[model samples]
Target: MSTTEVLHHHHKHCDELFADAEAAGLHGDWAASAASFARFRDELLAHFATEEQVLFPAFEAATGMTGGPTQMMRFEHAQMRELIEQMEAALDQRGREAFAGAAETLLMLMQQHNMKEENILYPMCNRTLADTVDVAAGLRQRLEEACPVSA
Candidate 1:
């Protein structure tokens, strides 16, 4: 599969997990909420690491552009991580309003982030990485390792 295809699949997987966590918490299922949020947090962090540590660096090397879209993506990722931390804390406290509010904010941020990645970065990665064999494969392998196929 292409880089875009694989990363897009991961996006869907993460999104499903996000929906599960948000729904569980919003519906007052405290136990399910906590468990699902934990899973979602773990998967989200793994996804972020896959992009920041592997995909972004590889794309930078391939294109020789260090401070382009990838930089912006890294910034957004840090923002998302902070929100996730807050959400996790809220879940711990069983603060329904807090968790839901954070989830709403995260949902918006994720929508924008995923759009930029799927429409721009993923295509660029597909094109740029196509110049060399195994780079895309390596990225896919790294992602799969970071987040298992539990989806």
Candidate 2:
């Protein structure tokens, strides 16, 4: 499969985990909710790591657009990281409202961020780097190492 297709699939995985965490929290099961949230966070971080470390660099090297779209994506990634840190604090305290509030914000941010990546940047990556040898290799390596086969 293509690189964009792989990333799209990963997005769906993350979304599922996010929904699981949300459900667990709303169910009032504290331990299960924490575990679910941790799972979601792990997948989310892996997704970001692979995108930032592998995909973005490949796209930038291929397209020579380092200061453009990839820059914006990196900025958004940093913002998401901050929200994640806040979520960590909320989770630590078992503060349901705080966690839920931060999660809502993160979900909104993720939706917008993912739209741009899926519709705009990913297509660009597919078109620009399809012939390159390392695109798929890099994706597979990160997928194997950073993300789980199933979650």
Candidate 3:
């Protein structure tokens, strides 16, 4: 798979977990909601780590563009991380409204972030880093480690 495809798949997987958590929260199942939200947060953070540690470095090295799209993405990742921390606190407090509010903001930010990455950043990475670095492999390995399949 290409870099864009791998990351896009991960985005969809995280979206599913986010939806599950939101549904559980709506239904007043705090335990289930917490579990699902934890999974979503873990997976999303892992994705960010992979991009920052592997893909971004490779792209920056290849294109010599450190303070461009990768920088913006890093900033957004920090925002998401902060929001995730807030969501975790909300969950701990069992504050459904607070959690939902944070989730709503997170969802909006994530949608915009994902679009920018998929459309602009990933394509740039695919063009610049595809031959030099196995970004898709790195992404898949990191994501699999983040959410290993059971069987």
Alpha carbon lDDT at 76, candidate 1? 98
The 10 consecutive residues of candidate 2 with the worst lDDT sum are 131-140
Best by lDDT: 3
Q: Please, what is the TM-score per model? A: 0.87, 0.88, 0.91
**Model 1: residue 75 alpha-carbon error in angstroms:** 0.4
Model 3, span 53-110: residue lDDT tens: 8889989998899999999999999999998998889888888898898889999999
* CA deviation > 4 Å runs, candidate 2: 131-151
Q: Kindly list the per-residue Cα lDDT of model 1 for residues 1-151, writing each as its tens digit.
A: 7765766887788899999999999999999988888878877787787778777887899889999999999999999999999898998898999999999999999989999998988899988877444444645565566557653
Report lDDT per candidate: 0.83, 0.80, 0.86
lDDT for each residue of candidate 2 in 105-145, tens digit (9 for 90 to 100): 98999999999998999888888878463444555665566
